[model samples]
Target: LDRLFARHEALRSVFVAPQAKPRVEILPPDAGLPVSEHDLRQRADTEAALSDLCHEEERTPFDLARGPLIRGRLVRMSDEEHVFLLTQHHIISDGWSMGVLVRELGSLYRAFVAGQDDPLPPLAVQYPDYAAWQRQWLSGERLQKQAQYWREALSGVPSMLALPTDRARPAQQSFAGASVPVVIDVDLTRDLKRRSRQHGTTLFMTVLAAWAAVLSRLSGQNDLVIGVPSANRGRREIEELIGFFVNTLALRVDLSGEPSVSELLERTRRTTLAAQEHQDLPFEQVVEIVRPPRALDHTPLFQVMLAWENHAGPSFDLPGLSVEAADGLDQVK
Candidate 1:
């Protein structure tokens, strides 16, 4: 864990100054993670206890200005069974960084078990270096070009999708939500893959097209805009680096004229590709460029967000343990 902290400077960094103009302050090497240990073997309902403990950790807020924004806990269920909990703030890391962290941790664990030195090479660039490069690259003419693309793309977009709701929207927005897993059977999955291949499109594009159709039905609106997240790790240097590099792209889904399925998929493919070409522009800047009417009850640009886990998932190849994800503990609210 100490080596993990040393390798990723974001683990020891904190944000300071006004919220609008926040700056990162990297702490000294002495700053470290305080991993608390717990023994749940004595408890009769060990799984329930673990779930409660993890939920408690999730609810505990981090102090962004004070110091470390990550927390770790090790729980022992039996002689050979143990669970490690890691909670981190999104300011320093994103979904892609989590995958990188887990992959590196597995490599480090295997090497250490063999009495070998750290096999991983030193990082070529830290989080701050990437931040500096981003600011430098996205400026002047380059920035204006991307901004112009968004201005034309989102021009005359609807303020929000008229998604039917049972209750009235609150005055303020909230992130409190629950995730319900919907399973698509094997036959449907296989057919979807086959169709994607037939159309020369990815599963992501096909599913996104279908999703836009569903939203069109629910909202009774044909013209829809959905927000999609991009990893934004086009540069190889930042691929393995642990930091927050995720960007959101607004995809305008046009379902006018009751287009056929194939036509809709083709349109979605074109929109996705065009957005990817100009994805370097941050979503916040895109909002500023479009100048959408803002309301406290909802977000700007697009209200409905689509986060497809289309990238590689976390890989944990530990040596001598039966590994499976624990339910409920993975949820963040």
Candidate 2:
């Protein structure tokens, strides 16, 4: 815990408001982070008790202005079974940051149990330093070049997609959504992987191509755009840092001419590569340049979002602990 606190400056960040533009104030390292413990072994229904505890924690929101944005707890279900829950605000962390945290925590725990020194090396640069460099670099000519590209690429594109929904469209849309799990059979998964390898593209691009086809068939719209989150961690210095380095890219995939699956995959691959070339341009700047027509009932540019989880938390083989990934909804809201 001490090492993690000292390593990542964003963990201690607090948002300072009341100014024209909000700024982050990184506080000094504290003694230790707050962690609660619960003993559910005494309860008659341990599974129900664990679920209630997690729901309570999820319902509790963090105060951005206050300190200790991250919270954790340890729940004991039995003498040999336990669960650890950690929560943090999205402003301070991201999917990649969570992977870093889990890997580092496992390393730190193993070292502490063995009574050894910390093995992690010093970071090349912190989050604040990256912010400073970004502000200085992304401006003037560079910003204008990327902005012009986006303007031309998204010219005359439809602002909203007509996805078929069961409920009627409301005056103002509500973000309340649900997740339905879709499982792909083993044969299909294997074939997708093989096709991706053969095409020299990623599985993500292939899946996205299929999704675009589905949307095209549903709405009868050949030209469409979908929003995707890019890791935007192009710099080697901030690759391992714990911060919000992700950016959204408006990927415009064309499915006209009744192209075959392979042809669509090729088209999607080219589109993704082109967008990735200019991904440094912030999404806000793109929105300003393109000036997509906004609607009160739906989002601008693209309503559907597709995210690819390229980073997975490291595996741990600690002495008495069985580590497994947790399942959750993948909605943006």
Best model number under lDDT: 1
What lDDT score belongs to each candidate, Candidate 1 first?
A: 0.88, 0.85
Q: State every prediction's TM-score relative to the real structure.
A: 0.92, 0.91
Instruction: List the candidate 2 regions with Cα displacement exceeding 4 Å.
Output: 193-200, 326-333
Model 2 agreement with the true structure over 40-117: per-residue lDDT tens digits: 989999988887888898898888877678777788989987787878888888888877887787888888789998
What's the residue-level lDDT of 176 in candidate 1? 77
Q: Counting only residues 3 or more apart in sequence or on different chains, how many pairs clash (N, Cα, C under 3 Å) in candidate 1? A: 0
Give the distance in Å from residue 97's predicted Cα in candidate 2 to where it truly belongs. Answer: 1.2
